[model samples]
Target chain A: MKSILIAMLVAMTLPFGLATPACAGSGDVVVENAWSRASIGTSRPGAAYMDIRNAGDEDVTLTGLRTDLAGMPEFHLTSTNNQGVSSMSPVGEIAIAPGETVALAPGGMHAMLMQLRRPMEEGGTFPLTLLFSDGGEVTVEVPIRGIAARGPDD
Target chain B: MRRRSVLGYGAAAFGVIGMTLFAGWWRVDGPGAPQAVGARPLPLTEMEFSLTNHEDRTVGPETLIGSPTIAFFGFTYCPDVCPTTLADISDWLDALEGDAEKLNVVFITVDPERDTVEAMAEYVDYFHPAIRGWTGTERQIARAVEGFRATYEKVPTESGGYTMNHTASVFLFDAQGRFVSTIDYHEPREFAVPKIRRAMNDEEAEGA
Candidate 1:
């Protein structure tokens, strides 16, 4: 009965077009808008964007990502300098403070899905596991949007 | 009366010299000039480059000029900014109504080793139908970037694969090959469309 109630609470918290993977069951980290753009071709890498929130009293660190979608999945930050030149660099672990939400969106930090296994098509979905520093992981189904998708809601 | 005729002849000679100098200046930088008609020559437009378009045609600065053009530097492997900007460009063209056809939109690849003409063709197909893809040799791409004041650097990722860091801004040029302003990355559509229109108006604004 308690498990069923927790399921109900999870369903109530997540709305249509928003994805939150088992925060109630796994831990206090809630992920929403897990999505990626449709790749142009199989040779090119892809990227995923999402929002990870830490609802627990303690800080949570995102250590890594694992998925079958790409051979190498890493964290990348795309920064623009003052002269309007832009560049991307591999980022280290991301720490989410208590009640803080970390966003991986376009024009900023994102989950770099490198060396894609295949071309990610629009309307398709893939599973991704987010590894946390506490040895806990949450797997979310990432939906593929158009090549120009801004977010899950877009 | 003889002195009066001499003074008249001297005045006519001075007028002829002044006219010749004025005509030279006008032909060089005036409204009737054949190139960059009414405005200063845009350095980017003058920058020479020989590249192959997606359709396998030899294209240089002249092809891109003679019409309002927007050239964006990016690679097909780019997942976020390039696609987003292309989609934004498509939206701006849509907002342009029929006038969008009057403008030339080119997507130039900074990483030509991977982004071949075939790759560029398939890549630009995702966005507006009018977006033309251009790719060339590394030296050609370097030559092209020099004119726009654009820069690109290849950085190897930990995975041994490489990615490029390039200028994220879109360059805008008038029909006469005069440099206008640039549309920054992620510029709002409301602001972007107006800038495109401003470029479109350049020809008539200067009576060129």
Candidate 2:
């Protein structure tokens, strides 16, 4: 009887451990080097960056992002005028190829955290949720980094 | 007996309430009422020079001498920094309420090739009617920028085009053309606005 009870307990815990597979639809989408910029106290906006790798066999499109620290979240791209000027524009979608990765960094494509509710202190972490086009969401903890920190592509 | 008693009570209550309200209202509307007004004032700086306005007119720097000036530098082709900074400035100016008139905002373009006097006028107009755009010959603008130690340089790209890498500080100058301070392009309003107001008030106190 003792051995049977132990076996039943193990069986019950096994499903609990494996239950995570249901929420992570296409397996784990790894978010590496995720970071957000420190907010300036004024009408200042900050940018967040990271590398997204879709190790699964299916392509993934990043549809949206949400953060409590910002009034709104947007994906953006920074372009330099070959004529000697640099500018940034809004990027609508970022597609991640199967078994490939997309990077967001400074002076390139990045996530804009607008209307910051508080200043991002260095070494601090904040919660952000990234929604994939296929209705899957991944929550990440982003580290606050200095302005000089280079992104993956940089 | 009951009717007479009720009528007497009603008349007594009405007279007492009316008298109390009349006294309170009279006191509030009387000449001795308290008045609240803003006591803090921004300071003014003055400077004089003959520079060209975006209208191609030779307007002296003296035109900016009477009011506080917010100045920024960038070229016309700049995709992000210039417009973002200018838009922020416009928002800041709009928030100033009655304090807006005491300010003279200037957008000075570093790319003289594209930002002509007419072009600057049109561009600055897009942000705020109160903002003035200033552009001049390369040599003239170079001299002006030199006076403030602001710097910019051009680098060639693979497409045979060039990009300008320039300083991104927005300078606050007093009416006298003296550099009061510098605000980082992305600094929050909590820091920027209060500092600007302080600078203005300091100038006023000194003038007084």
Candidate 3:
């Protein structure tokens, strides 16, 4: 299946501890397993999840996110309080250290795509540009899975 | 002397009534209430809701009288818990196979202002065919929330938009409209499916 291929691709892209660090300050942030769910409608926002691995030797802070799929993309966290009530709120940038992987997965941290340009249909892909504080931008193709999909593997 | 005897009888009568009420509470909302991490007791008494389904049909408490029901409160814009829970519900139904049809799954929207009938139709349709979406006016939604003893509020986000905070547990009811149990958010299928079946197998088994 397509998701399996994506999983394989993510596994292959993982750090193997080979190759020298790039000095030009690009490709330092490797994103893997980037996937999103099919939106209910164009008006309602969609969520994109992925794992960000910092391959560089320096600490990099993810400043912002951008995509044509939505008017604005913000880092949102969905948290459940002790009262069994759930709330989603916007969060700040994420920082990744060298050789560290930060996951923006379901039921936790995610990129909330707001005011979609169009519906994110299943079997589709969108380009998401992750802006880093180091003036580097990494764009990854996010595959669209089913509405109820748990993750890229699912 | 007469006052002392009258007082004794009054205390004994109150004690009997208290035990009766507690026994009823213990039967309905006692055990299952604690199993859920943050669950509130599904109202001690019967709760009801009258709303319009995604199919544009009016569904009320009476309409679900003969079947076991699962009612969940959430919104369409909720990307995390709502979708995750709905997916679990879909999987639970799949696990149930034939028995799934015996259950009535209803997803009621807390944010009716944005969740229109058309919106709910598409939302629930994406999860499962049997899952029904319901939406009503603000007043109607408030009544439903109050009746079910659930809570929800619209919180303003930094983007000048609003998101909803709502009860995340799924409520199960017997065919007689009595509260049976609650399934927490992200509850494993091993536990959730049995709760659904338990509700389904209660008094007046479905498909009779």
Q: For every model shown, what is its TM-score relative to the native structure?
A: 0.81, 0.49, 0.79
**Candidate 3 Cα errors over 4 Å, as ranges:** A1-26, B1-45, B204-208
Cα lDDT tens digits, model 2, B13-52, are: 9999998888877766656444311111122222223456
lDDT of 1 by residue, B1-208 (tens): 9999999999999999999988988887676565331222245557898999999899988897678888889998887778877888988888998999999999999999988899988888878888999999999999888777777899887888888888888889988888888888888899999999998899568745
Q: Candidate 1: which stretches are off by over 4 Å?
A: A1-26, B1-41
Model 3 C-alpha lDDT per residue in residues B3-91, reported as the tens digit of each score = 99999999999999999988888866886344443444444245566799999999776776777899899999888789988988899
In the range A1-154, model 1's lDDT, one tens digit per residue, is 4533654465455443244344432277677768888987677889898878776667778889999989898888998776566889888898889878899988898999988888899999998898887777878888999886656855
Pairs that collide, model 1? none
Tell me which of candidates 2 and 3 scores higher on DockQ.
Answer: 3
lDDT of 3 at A71: 92
- What tier of docking accuracy does candidate 3 attain? acceptable
Best model per TM-score: 1
Which candidate has the top score in DockQ? 3
